[model samples]
Target: VTGSPGAVITLDTTAGVVFQLNPQTFPALDMAGADDIHLRNLSGSEFSTSVNLVADITTLADGVTPIGNNKYFNLVIWGGQNRTGQTSHLYCNLPIGQYGKQGDAIVDAEKFSVHTIPNDFRGVGFLIGELTFQFSSGGGGTWALIQERVLLGHFPILIPGGGTTTIISTFVDSSFEIFGNLDDTKRIAFQADSITTGTTRIITMADVNVDLADIATNNAKVSNVTHTGDVTGATALTLDLNNLGTETSIASGDFLAMVDITDSGSEKITFDNLQANIVKTGALNSGSITSGFGNIDIGSSTIDAGTIDGTAVTATTQLVSNIWKDINALDVKAEYTGSQTGHADFDGTDDSVSIADREEYDGTGVF
Candidate 1:
């Protein structure tokens, strides 16, 4: 026992003997029931009364086992701060394993409770409840149980449309940005007006189908070009070599032709005016040409027909031959018709030039 001002008391045990203290003793007054008792045997041994004492005694049962495996030490405390902020009440030094067992060890629980008049504690967020359980063997450490659980009030719910029980979320002015990659399989979709819940949405596109059955038709040109559908009463189509160069080849189906090709690569083939058509014209001129071999190859001349003209001469052939060879072996078919009597250097530079090579000189002209 301990008294104020450095006065220490002792307890002695004798065989077959018991000792007790009364409230009406020396230097002690008004002490009764276990409420106003204090012990001060501060020696660092098992005799220290501070070892198993607690703020509340309800945790320790009146009759309980002292020590063993699977022991129990439960502490149910009400109205304490969870000071650590981990929970909503107060708890400290909580042992891991023995935190929630019933009493069966050296020490018991420290329990307390608070009762409020609801009006006196209107707005104060006070401590609510705490429970702890702990246990241990004959080690120097005595584990403790600590826990705290809290409760709160309910909020008001606003209903919309009076039919569907929809879950409405109210955010206090918050925005977020999500970024990631998208591929053919994955996509994004729209959900409601402001709410979305899926991981992603997919958008799709397809070929556009046109309905031309109602529109007026246009006159299509067809000739040197092949017409697949209908070109009934249409203007003649022509493939202009305009701006096209030599050494180029044009092909369709199996027919391939190359014409008007040059070595300097300066002069290009010219098709002044070309009418539109589905038919393709493969000129030895500028079109599509593959190098290393012949200038052009018109796959099948039986299908595509046209006169192959060149600078030196003109040749008419059903099949397309070598581009340069045909131009060199051109046959003069346009005969001289004007009368000067004799022939002149086939004045090719002049309009009176004849298809023949012989020319006449002097006023009478040389034959």
Candidate 2:
């Protein structure tokens, strides 16, 4: 093909690769005929891109205005500002005739790519500042200019800032850029929203080695503990905060702390031995304890309401311990046995009773 005075021409062929001679071409090419193609805009009625797009981020901006305070990096601005007309495209060759249609937008249309800031702008070492943005695909017709947003990427790592700060974990349905710092000393700023509950979304936190003495029966938010959101489950950190130890003032009710689970009162929570100033009534002892007491388990002394089976019983002035007796030594008898009988009435002066069995009694109360 050859250049004309004021007219343009297009040539499309499928007879292998066409090589044009430098000195002179075949005949002056005429593309007006039905057998030829004309070069024109790749976009249709709606201007779609012709090839993959390159979006260079040069500056950071507080607001997208001409006079807005903008931070430029290597003469380029990021945050979708100052990058509209600075885009370049690497086009893909398309045989428009390959598909039966007149032309495929994607064939002539450009693919898109969100480019990172030039390595020169990243700097060698870390300089501390705050940075954040959200990224998403607007639609399929962003051809004239590359639209972009910020996301967590090669940017500087963010550190945990405020201890009382609270933020939604899930950013609705959009992209969430809650990237924390690489340092292990940092923690999350707030409760991250998990759209799902139970099994779907899981919120993770640092494990805590609990010191039981620090946790109180009513309040457990002592130490460096800070909870930004509600927690559920046995393995959650709340379990460690909950004080399972019993308190004397607890009014006939169960006590649950940060963790909802608690040991049932119906079950037994036994210890090696109970050593307290006031020996409170236990499950085995149905009666109430009125005075201060000493250790009951020590010195082989047993304390219980029912018949206890142990060594001996000793009582001090303020201490009273139950004497456990063996079941076999219990003195028990019926009112009357079938073979044995005793007189109902006794002589008033002598005060003696007659038994039908002569051999059953000794001379002291001879039958």
Candidate 3:
């Protein structure tokens, strides 16, 4: 008989009742992914789904609720039904008992890593507090043939004062071992610690990897400093010393040197006596002189053979030596003038001639 919404169903035992157990598809539970689930009573008063559940859920019913939120009596949890075990793939919310209220079961004393499956019966078997387990038939009748089968079971655990325990199992207790992939495995390990005065003790994993881009923090100012790295592709760099007090000089061992110009069109170092410094250097690589300038000072400077490219060149010693050598080569002899002015006759011209007489006979021959 199908347990559909309008289907007839019956209750077992001597005190029988004919009614449905609300088989209207209790929405499936979700796997706990990076979260934890807290168990509480059926009133939904002190329950927390965070840090406990990993997926979206439908009904968070406590299987042990005795028709109401009565802590004294025991409760029953009829196995949820699904054709292909679709509804039972997620974990159940077990009660987290207090220190004094927790039972002697091993799973209750410590944190349990729970595994869930799609099957109605999970491989997990644990006892907490006063909760008990019982099996049922799909037809609402007694299935005595499968009574010896251990569908779910729990054992006692002796835990240390402060330690951790890991629980690893499949979702349902079944003889089938179809899951061979390690991705579907679940291990829920929990650690216990002692709390300080005002601080609550909790377990934390070290070395957490996080996406720093998601964090919103202060924008820090980075200082100007040289960073050391591999010297493979670094070709050029510039440095500005405008804020420095005095002139900075590069030391001998310093190989890399560069200067950055000011952005306001101002020169870094403006030399006033640029021409004077050029004169002191004596030789210019390639330069031109100013038009209508003073004398060219090639004085006592031994220029290279093919260095001078100008047309005219004159100097003190050069003028004196040339004039004296020409005058000394002239041959002069004695000569007589009109009355008695004895004169010396040069090789071709008169050596002695009166200043006034020479001017008077300028148009004619020499007198």
Best by TM-score: 2
Model 2 agreement with the true structure over 62-172: per-residue lDDT tens digits: 112221111111111121111223321111111111111111111111111112232443432121111121112233112121121222132423312211113434342
User: Worst lDDT window (10 residues) for model 3?
Assistant: 142-151
Assess every candidate by TM-score.
0.16, 0.18, 0.16
Tens digits of per-residue lDDT for model 1, 258-318? 2233333433334573433334444444454357865555455553455545444322322
**Tens digit per residue, CA lDDT, model 3, 1-367:** 1121111211121111112243233233322233223333323533343331212111224333221111111111123334333432112333322111112122233232222222323323222222221212234322111111112222323321111245535322122123225742433333223346587555476788766453344233334444344323323433343333332443532323343333333323333323322113323435466758775667786545444333322232111111111233332223234554332222224333332311221222232
> Best to worst by TM-score, what's the order?
2, 3, 1
The CA lDDT at 286 in model 3 is: 51
TM-score of 1: 0.16
Residue 5's lDDT in candidate 2: 14
